[model samples]
Structure formats: structure tokens, C-alpha cells
Target: MLKVQEIRELIKLIDQSTIDEFTYEHEGEKIKMKKQILTAQAQTTLVQAPVETSPPALQKNTAQVEIQPGAQQHTEVAAPQVEEQRGENLAEVKSPMVGTFYHASSPDAEPFVKVGSKISADSTVCIVEAMKLFNEIEAEVSGEIMEILVKDGQLVEYGQPLFLVKE
Candidate 1:
């Protein structure tokens, strides 16, 4: 089995090379990767919803999104902007794979981490359910949990930031 760091290194290598696809299998574990080229305009699909209030200033934003390739999902543009305003001192704990994020192991259980909670690199921050498999996500960075980006049971995409930690 390959470690996350190893997989990340492999991705960097594959991305830098001219190779469009790569696959590897070992010990019943299989990994496959592919790259797709998209034009700048086609890469983003922005949607602006009608304003509910009579005033434009009242609404936070008209609504804008940057759609990912192969996934038509659109997220609020303000989230990232808010993240940026929070400052660069914060480190993001991103999702390794697309799945439903769960702060706790079960609905009735207490969450793994919360705002102001201190965490080590090995601490379990949350769980993501993908294909019925519950995968535990680590904090990976030693810091205090500053923000929770997604709600429990919300569907998250690959590489999407889940939590922000202040180191």
C-alpha cells in the first residue's frame, strides 16, 4: 500500500510529465489516474441567483461558482473569499476523496474536533463516507481547529477544504 505522501508525489510527477494516464496495482490495492484538458471558459460555470431582497447591498453575493471538471456542482463564491479574509496563517485540512463529511463517527456521538480544540498531526479530525466505506481523516497538521467549512452529512468533493487550523 502507498502512503498519502507517496500518492501526492506520484500525482506531481504525473502532472509534470507528458503522460496523460497512469495505473498501478499491488497487494489487491489499485490506483489509477488520468488528466483532462479544459479551456479556461469551459472550466468555470458561474450561476447568479435572483436576489430575494429588494436591496442589492443586503445580499452577501449575487451568487457565483467555479465548477470542477466532470462535476457540475457549484459552491458559494463567498466561502473561499471568506477563507482568504481569515488570513493565510490558517492551514486547510482538505478532503482526500469525494464523499459525505461527518464530524462524528455516528449521529449521536460527539464530534471528533471543534472550534478552539487543539489537535496533533495524528489526531482524527473527521470521517468521510465514500461508497459506504467510512474513512477517517487526520488533522495532519498540529494546530487549533479554527473553522469547520462543511456541515455534517454534507457531500464534499475531492481536495475540498474541510477545516481550517491555526498553527
Candidate 2:
């Protein structure tokens, strides 16, 4: 079994390097770590094989590690793509997590922010539901909502632009 500090070090290394995934197997232990660009996080799965088993079979055990946005140096590469898709004057409100996008707090309520709506840095423009958790996404920039890039109930990945604003 790998120690917590060792696992942390591995995650740090993976976060700094360009490798998106890493796996290791030795004796009865196996470890797998995969980096997800959208959320700037990494998930690790560890499997231990029973000594008595004729053929080693993996046991279900998993752990997840989240690297902060600052640790994701590769995200800078995607900035140019977004700039190319959107004009220089437009600011994008991106999804911070991979989940279903909802325009309003509930289906019966009016949408949080619509086209032509003015928003400030703290404005809650939409909700992103991931693993049954509803997270209110803020605009993070003051601007007028110029476009809604995604539809309600649509699945959106991390870093996907949900709305375009003219700042």
C-alpha cells in the first residue's frame, strides 16, 4: 500500500507534468491515476489482490485528488482556443465542473440570468449539478449577458463556456 505522502507527491508530479494518466502494478498492489482537464483534477484508483487467489483479481477501492486551478498549467493552452472562438471583446463564463447545466434554480422558476441581463462579479448566472450536488455558478466578471452558449439540462464539461458576456 502506498503512503498518503507518497500519493500526494505523485499527484503533484502529475499535475506539473504533461502526463495525463499514470498506472503502476507490483506484486498484489495496483495504482491508477488519471488527470481530467476540465475540472483540473485527478482521480486515483487503488486495487489490492488477495494472496490466496490463483489469479489476482482487483478489489474495489478508489480515491480522488483535486488539484487547484493554479496547479493546472496546461489550462493556459485552452485559453487561445476560447479566444479564437470568441471575439476579444467577449468574456466567457465557463463551467467549473462537469455536470448538467440548469439555467434556473428549479425547473419551475425563471432562469437566473437571460440574454441582455446585466451581471456583476457575484451574480449567480446558472447552476451546475454534479453527483446530485447543485452548485451555483457565478459570472465572476461584470458584464451584460450577450449569449447563452448552452441549453438547460445539457451536460457540460469543465471549462466549457456556458454564457458569453460583453464586458
Candidate 3:
């Protein structure tokens, strides 16, 4: 279990980072947070409900609540699109958890696998560090790495594609 302060800090970090969602589990307690954007219709519903209850008092407040269409836009971020363009069969190695992706065991060491490097099913392709724990991510499929979708030290979310492999 995480403390309240720790959870607050985690939320703050997620808000500041580019990650869309975060999930953490410890001893059976799991916490997940996702960034949400309110649609224009939803925002209007939220503001209109309170104004209808109090007419005079919230008359000034209603004027201040302006619902601008396409003002606060929400753009969907696309996941890595490292599909095989050569028509060869390809497999994706996705991240299992949300964390900082590391290409090597250490800062000075070489990357575990690069483009054109052949890997087996159980090969350790990368590491994801979450809350001081280093998790070894496996290839899960035998193939040659065709493209690395993420850069070193990049923050990745769960189910995000890390590499495209030619199977």
C-alpha cells in the first residue's frame, strides 16, 4: 500500500508528464489513474445543473461559464506505429507496466537489443523501472528487431508498443 502523500506525489508527477495513464500495484492494492478531458456537451451539462438550482445567486456565475466549442481541445495521442512496411510478418513487444523505459541494464552498458538483432522468446529486451524496482521485459516471440519505438529513458505506459519485430 502507498501512503496518501506518496499517492499525491505520484498524481502530481503524472499530471506533469506526458503519460496518459499510470497503474501501480503492491501487496494486492492497486491504483490506476488516467487523464480525462471533458467534452463540450459534458462541460455544458456540468455548468447548467448548478445554475438551474439557484437562479439569482448564480446568474453572474452562469455568465462567466462560457462553453467554447473546440476551445479546450483534446487530441488523441497515437501509440508507436512501427509496423512492418515490407509485408513480412511482424510482432510487437509491448510494455507490461507503466514506468521509465531503459534500453540497457546500466547507463554505461550497451543496449540489450538493437535493430537487426535476433532475439528468442525468453530474451530480455529491455528494463522498466518503477518505484525503484527494475523489471526485465522479455521478447516473448522469436524474431529480429526491426524498429525500436521508444527512446532510452522515455516514460512508457502499460500496453504501449516498445519494439516491432520481424517474425
* Top TM-score model: 2
| Residues 1-167 of candidate 2: C-alpha lDDT, one tens digit per residue | 55543554454455456776777666655556665444432222323311111111231222223222222211111211222135877888887765799999988999999999999999999999976889999898888999999999998764577999998
Q: What TM-score would each prediction reach against the true structure?
A: 0.55, 0.55, 0.51
Model 3 residue 13 CA deviation in Å: 20
How close is each model in CA RMSD to the real structure? Answer: 12.0, 13.3, 14.5
Give candidate 1 misplaced runs (Cα > 4 Å): 1-19, 22-86
State which candidate, 1 or 3, has the greater TM-score.
1
Clashes of each: 0, 0, 0
Model 3, range 57-87, lDDT digits (tens) per residue?
1111111122223332122221222222335
- What TM-score number comes out for model 3? 0.51
Structure candidate 3, residue pairs in collision: none
Sort by TM-score, top down from the best: 2, 1, 3
